[model samples]
Target chain A: MKLKVFLAVFACKLTIKLLRLLGRGGTAIPGKIALRICPDLLFQLAKDVKCVVVTGTNGKTTSSRIIEEIYVKAEASYFANRSGANLINGITSIFIENSTLTGKPKKENAVIECDEAASKEVCRLINPAVVLVTNVFRDQLDRYGEVSGTLENILIGIKNSPRAVVCLNSDCSLTASIAEQIPNRVIFYGVDVPIYKNPVSEVSDAPHCIKCKHEYEYSYRTFGHLGGFCCPDCGYKRPEPQVSVTDILSTELSFTKVRVQVFGEDDVITINLPGGYNIYNAVGALAVSEAVGFRRMLAKDAIASFTCGFGRMEEFDLGGHSARIILVKNPAGANQVLNYLAGLSAETVFVCCLNDNSADGKDVSWVWDANFEKLADMSELIPEIYVSGIRSGDMAVRLKYAGIDEDKLRIFDDYDELIDAMKNQSLPVIIMPTYTAMMDLRAKMSTAFGGKEFWE
Target chain B: MKLSICHLYPDVLNLYGDTGNIICLKKRLEWRGIDTEVTLLPIGANADLSRFDLFFIGGGQDFEQEVLLTDLHGGKDKEILAAVEDEKVFLCICGGYQMMGQYYLTHTGQQCDYIGALKLHTVGSDVRMIGNYMFKCAEESSGSTIVGFENHSGRTYLGEGVSPLGTVLHGFGNNGEDHTEGARFKNVFGAYCHGPMLPKNPEFADLILQTALSRRYPGTVLPPLGDGLEINAHDHMADRMEKQ
Candidate 1:
């Protein structure tokens, strides 16, 4: 290795240690500083490791965790980016931390979760053995522009890694379209049956066909635009998935039992997480593991026992009352959360925290697209709705327009007061927070209550 | 009183929660005991545009805008022009606002034909002027400060025939080169604001409703509903923008 490479690695290592000592969890700065010294540090560090990169709008972190669980089950030596640091700089920091000062990778295997916008460069540098795209949705309009723009970014990333086997969600028309253009070996995973019992009328991010502008007709829809989509005019349709959820045997708040078909073989799997999106994540994880040449039974076992980390339906106890924090960034994801909320039979306290910070997309207008009006139908079950965060006023007005009674809406600008207000509530509480608000509130919740810090 | 709203290209030009403007308009009207009907006019939908009291068109992606341009050129452009001439209240936002002009010159120098309902034109740029923006309405006696989020690359310029909707108070509006934010030709209102441009600004929503109502029932006065929550929300956003 050159003197600059050695010095970059040493500096990155020292910065990580210093940050840990200071109780500050930041991977981007160290990786940035190291890259400033040596521009190709990540390429040098990640070149030797066999990586499986996960990139999509939603379920990236959760899918990465599930994939990591499979690696653990197989007893493979691997390191994954666990704390939501999926950007280029943060991902570079992970590679540096998992490698030696001589620029040799310490781990033989790596599972990387990459941001959609940064995936093109990351994939080109990492050159992963397998790339899993969970699904695509309208996410962070201010940051990513449009859903098609986001899809284009991911497509560019996949194009860079022609050798990598691409695992895609067939249900997502945007994701499935990648298979048609790329020469890479593609495997698809999706729910074969409709997840919802009732008909849904939510907005579709990909309403029109990707190939043509013709409207898509769905045989059955799982959620927002993810379904058995086919264009009448262009003849473009959903591809048959190799790994598919053939049937949802049972679904509960805690877990879901599904019959999954893996490469012509059928197996009844229990996804430890709830919701239909998690099932998609589970299937995508299995497809990626299978693409990476891992055993099907190991992937199934890992998914069956895996528990998700911070803010992806993370449960917490708020002074005797149970609260669940679900991080919502976009309309599609927020709609799914609202759909989950609409299914509850018991009365609950619903809290919506919206922030316009850089990480949270800066535009609070997406709250309107999220069909919060569905909550108005279940007004009896959801007694009170609390709007918090920096843009709580905007959220409060949004909920009011959604037919939520003005009497039911309360604004909590202060986090301490918001936490205190929910502490003594007897009913189950569901807290939906955007990215930045979730980070800040999760820290406060961890500090007040007993929970693991994000970096820990 | 009844107001018929034609939501143009709801399937294509519905970005950044632009449907929220329609929702706000509908709810605010319903609250005041006014009956309203909203019809979605997607591409290829042939509707008598002059029959509707109000016409609403929201923003869309660049690709979707291109799709909309084809349909507008097909025949809807003439109908929309007729509606504008008939004094039907029209609120077009962002891409929809851009389409109201004669043409849009894209960043790649490609010229896309538009509806030509207003005397305005746009030139697309590589850099998008995005953020929370505030502007004071320029119309006489309507000094209300409008607050909304603008995310657009198309810098629009008003011609001699049309007047600007508002003067920029805080953020970049319209071309970023001028203080003008949006264009106005009679009752037709076009702007880049899409918080969907009305939910936070109740006065603007009511103004659209009142304008539509007056067109049908001349000398009609709209009764004021409780606007405490709406005003609070509007003030909060305006204050945040002013502080920045």
Candidate 2:
């Protein structure tokens, strides 16, 4: 077993070095090779490191970044899979890269963002100290089958890590239901108050009660089926959150200030990122921090100081004009970004890059599910609308049906052309791209304009 | 002219932008100066099916479909069947399409009965048929080519005497085995395509609208809206499908 572990580590390290030399970014390939050599290599490398695994549909990367800040502020020795490589192979590669050739971890702690479907086996092997599920939304239906299947996958992960403290979003009924099934130490986090003045109502992924088949009744919905929910028939309700945003003091383009109640004590927290969705992520980060033995003030300060995640409201100065790339995959996330765009009073140019790549959930039908109608509703604020990517036509059609004037719509199949169009414009540009589209466009923008590569 | 559209079980079955069909139907009618009302009948809602001229049921996950089976068995199926027999225009997609069939046999050999509004039955498989696909409407229909995305694991087969809504031109339709895509019986239409099935295919959207409207005003002709964007989107998919 020891020989196998050592051989796996050596092979993985060699592959990583070779890939770097070849100028190829293969985050999951080396780990795949190592795992083939020794299937138990992850269990060996992750044995000594304390880990906090963040997994869910929407806020995994953002929440993990916030937790990384908490780790940094505390001056703890840690490593992270910060390159959006959340699958088992990618996570294994991260572990092996952070460890010695003998399959022993050099880092004392780790912050890992894991994909929901991959979390089941990854969490079992890593045996994290704290497992945080930000929230579960209907995402990548072709990949996970459905929202319930995603929930089941996460549930199995939480179930496997029985010793790990499970932190859940109380507002998400699908996520919150995991608490009922697991025997682990569970913590809940949510936003107590409605975050938006005018919330867009899309179809709820978890409309019926998990316990009973009855529809859920919301007292006040924050956005996209999340809020104070209670099932009338079986009495399944949103649990009282231990860490929650009690009130929103103010919301700005860059940040949001909110009064948060942790346990019984209340404190005002300035979430460095904007949008109501990030508020939930901030509170979720705090809850995970609490579970991981970080001080409340440390977590609060970390959230205040943490920058945005890659392609998540990530800013770039292109030819002296400001452009922000907001990654949108599913309806719930897209609606939140749309809500944030709606809040902007300044004239803006909206760029939507939609791809049907495997990473982007090939079914582009989700464009219709998201409330792009919000853009049409507030067309006075948005001067120009540009659509790009493999499915640009589908996106253009969706916007047309959403009531946006066809004259304002432009389709750019090339990223360079899309960037040029945005750069030529005077107004601030907000680019919303699907996963693969963002990666491709961000790479082009990084090369032409100036920004760090996503992995770096 | 006015038409009421009952979006049946939208709470449970609104997966894959399925409500886009509702948006397309509503917008097409409203664009023609026809007053349109959309009513959402969630699970356990007491819906008088006869009041609505058109009905739509989207798809859902197997878990949601399972949860919905109880509600359907609790007498809602009777209402839906009655409405289908009344020749009310109905559009069902994916799981909703499967539900309109007689029954669905699961991979585990468990048989689940549905409303049986059409002469069809489906069998679930582990291998899911998912991708962009194109099909041509049956001869009796517009015979226009329709493009949409299909993602389903249930292989549905229409019973004898029942006609298919369309023939698969490219990609897997009802099942990968058969060239048939969706079932058409009376005024009901069922398909597995949910690139929400309507917005991009303006002709199909208009056809459903015209059929529903003609119930109130016979020989109702829909004025053709400028479908340049929709046609471009549709052609993109059709072109891609042809290339593949």
| Per-candidate DockQ vs. reference | 0.79, 0.77
After superposition, the stretches of candidate 2 with alpha carbons farther than 4 Å from their true spots are none
In terms of lDDT, which candidate is strongest?
2
Runs off by more than 4 Å, candidate 1: none
Model 2: per-residue lDDT, tens digit, B18-133?
89999888888878899989998887788788999999999887666766888899999999999988999999999898999999998999999999888899999999898889
Candidate 1 local lDDT, A1-456, one digit each (tens): 478889998999999999999999987998999999999888888889999999999999889999999999999999999889899989989898998888888899999999999999999998889999988888889999888889999999999997899999999999999998999999999999998785346878888888888889999899999989999999999999999999999988888999999999999999998877899999999999899898888999999999896899898887677889999889888887887887677889999999999999888888888888888888999989999998888898899999999999889889999998898678889999999899999899988887887865
lDDT for residue B109 in candidate 2, whole number 0-100:
99
Per-prediction CA RMSD (Å): 1.2, 1.7
Which 10 consecutive positions of candidate 2 chain A have the poorest summed lDDT? A199-208
Per-residue lDDT tens digits of candidate 2, residues A275-298?
Answer: 889998899999999999888889
Question: By DockQ thresholds, what CAPRI class is model 1?
Answer: medium
Q: lDDT (CA) for every model shown? A: 0.89, 0.90
